[model samples]
Target: MAQIQASIEIDAPIDKVWSIVSDLDSEPKFWKGTKEVRNISKEGNTITREVTIAFKDSKCMQTVTLYPKEKIQIQFTKGVIEGTKALTLAQTGSKTRLDVIWDMKLTGMMGMFTGMIKKHIQSGSEQALESIKQEAQR
Candidate 1:
């Protein structure tokens, strides 16, 4: 398993950050790599989403586990993708510290070509964090 982790401090309450991060439908806006997300199914803490990433050649199906105001974890349920996870909204002092961890395994050629793309995605994640911070602080 490979993990790409990024963290940033937001000058807002945990609840504030949770509102934006928990809404999976609007993820594409702040998350640079996410081009679009459609909610396929939802029940309790589980939601199935179809997402098209910026560099990805095709859409991917993701099964996301939500923990209300605490965290949200997403993993690929189908398609060429292997694995992915995002941990959101960790509290630190009066502000909120959000951390996202992604673990992925590509098949065939995509696996070999993942290095540069992985770095780009990680950089985008970091930028997304800063965007969230600015929004929350406003």
Candidate 2:
């Protein structure tokens, strides 16, 4: 599996940061790789959704579980990618540290391009975190 991680410290409280990150539908605004999201089902804190990623406009099925103000776990259940992506939050005084980790591998023949894809995902994760920090600090 290929692993990628990104983190940012926002000048805001944990709740303030959580409020922004927990809004799954607004992900595309900050996450450039995620072009669109369509909810397939929701049960309490768990949501199964279809996410259209920028790579080849491919649609992936993700099971997302929100852990209040602490973390958000996303499991890629279907599509070209397979694995988990987690967003975790930590509170330090008045600042909140947000971290995103992706542990995944491309499926089938796409597995050969794992290195290239890893770079793209890593860059995208960093960009997304920066965007989130800007919104949370505002």
Best by TM-score: 2
Model number with the top lDDT: 2
Q: RMSD of each candidate?
A: 1.4, 0.6
lDDT of 2: 0.95
| Residue pair clashes in candidate 2 | none
In candidate 2, what are the lDDT values of residues 1-138, reduced to their tens digit? Answer: 998999899999999999999999999999999999999999999999999999899899999999999999999999999999999999999999999999999999989998998999999999999999999888
Q: What digit string (tens of lDDT, one per residue) describes model 1 on residues 26-105? A: 88889878888889899999999888877655688999999987888898987666797787777788989899988987
Candidate 1 lDDT for residue 72: 89
> What's the distance in Å from true for residue 75, model 1?
0.7
Question: Worst ten-residue run, lDDT, model 1?
Answer: 105-114
TM-score for each model: 0.92, 0.98
How far out, in Å, is residue 76 in model 2? Answer: 0.3
Local error of candidate 2 at residue 12 (angstroms): 0.3
